[model samples]
Target: MIKFNYPDGSHCYRALHTAHAVFRNDDGKLIARAEKADRTGMYEFEITGFELLSTGIVYD
Candidate 1:
């Protein structure tokens, strides 16, 4: 899973996928995407409509 922090400090998530993961809305339009930066649990996120507040790994 992918953990997401919203602009208002709220949190949400999406299914974890490859580096080129895509976050789309119900209309099949793109919302955001992610790329793994390194092994340090950091990732680069590109989002639309809402601000990309923050991101981190979810250790199971």
Candidate 2:
């Protein structure tokens, strides 16, 4: 498994799984990180839950 640091500043990601996050940069480039939740299994959250509330899809 490849490991990476989360991007700088605030960020949003597509949750592929409990341990994976897919992030798209401003340039439209994409990357996947290895971890999403901490040891307690809490999520870091994405898109402020607004889009998730309006639609089932997540946005970046």
Candidate 3:
């Protein structure tokens, strides 16, 4: 699971392993993008509009 929080306190995620996060809406359309931060536990998120709403998601 890809997990990280944006600077604005919003969060985005995906189920695939990649260098960047590609956020999609409920309709599965592209909405936002962010790259993994050089620092751990953070993401440089821009183009907001996505947030993970599911509960019980954990980092592997």
Candidate 4:
């Protein structure tokens, strides 16, 4: 797994079951990661409740 810091200066992690996050929404409410196979495949994310939000990537 990899680590990343959000726009709000908060920290979060990439989903082990999914791919590493490569893109995120402006409001930090959504995320989009690269696929393990092609690194350009589709990514899915669902934001709910008080889950951590991400706007951009800080590190890999």
Candidate 5:
């Protein structure tokens, strides 16, 4: 599991040994992306659009 701080100063935790995706609907436009694996065998990303929603890592 990965632990970090959000942009709002809140502590966040997520599972890193898996794949995940994110989506945003801004002004009726849909934007989507996925987390990429790095050399450290961990997936990393700066997740956004999670201000009011609680999110968790997804494994496939």
Candidate 6:
């Protein structure tokens, strides 16, 4: 099990099951990748083309 916190105070968890397949990138390099969650629970996903929100500061 792998866990991490996002910038929006949400948590994300991923189970490393097995390498589904190996695909080649644009440079023809083999890359090992696995399938993500099955979308059964609440998960935080970071959008690529979005601006960050300024929600004050988070102090741990």
Residue 44: error of model 4 in Å? 6.8
lDDT of 6 by residue, 1-60 (tens): 434344466644345443243345576544444454664443223321222233464433
Off by over 4 Å in 6: 18-34, 38-60
TM-score quality measure for candidate 1: 0.31
For residues 1-60, write the lDDT of model 5, one tens digit per residue. Answer: 544444455655545534354444555432323344453443444443332223574622
Models 1 onward score TM values of 0.31, 0.25, 0.29, 0.30, 0.28, 0.29
Candidate 2 — which residues are off by over 4 angstroms? 1-18, 35-60
lDDT of 4: 0.50
Among the numbered candidates, top lDDT falls to: 4
Displacement of residue 39 (Cα, Å) in model 1 is: 28
Q: Give the C-alpha miss distance for residue 1 in model 3, angstroms.
A: 0.9
Candidate 5 has an lDDT of 0.42
Q: List model 4 lDDT by residue over 1-60, tens digit each.
A: 445445466655655545545444777665545455556566555333123435584533
Residue 47, model 1: lDDT of 45
Q: Model 1 clash pairs?
A: none
Residue runs of model 4 more than 4 Å from their true location after superposition: 20-60
What is the lDDT, from 0 to 100, of the residue 19 in candidate 1? 33
Give the best candidate by TM-score: 1
Give the alpha carbon lDDT tens digit for every residue of 1-60 in model 2.
222334454544334344445566575555543443554544432222211222454433
For the record, the alpha-carbon RMSD of candidate 3 to the native fold, in angstroms, is 11.1
lDDT of 1: 0.49
lDDT of 4 at 17: 48
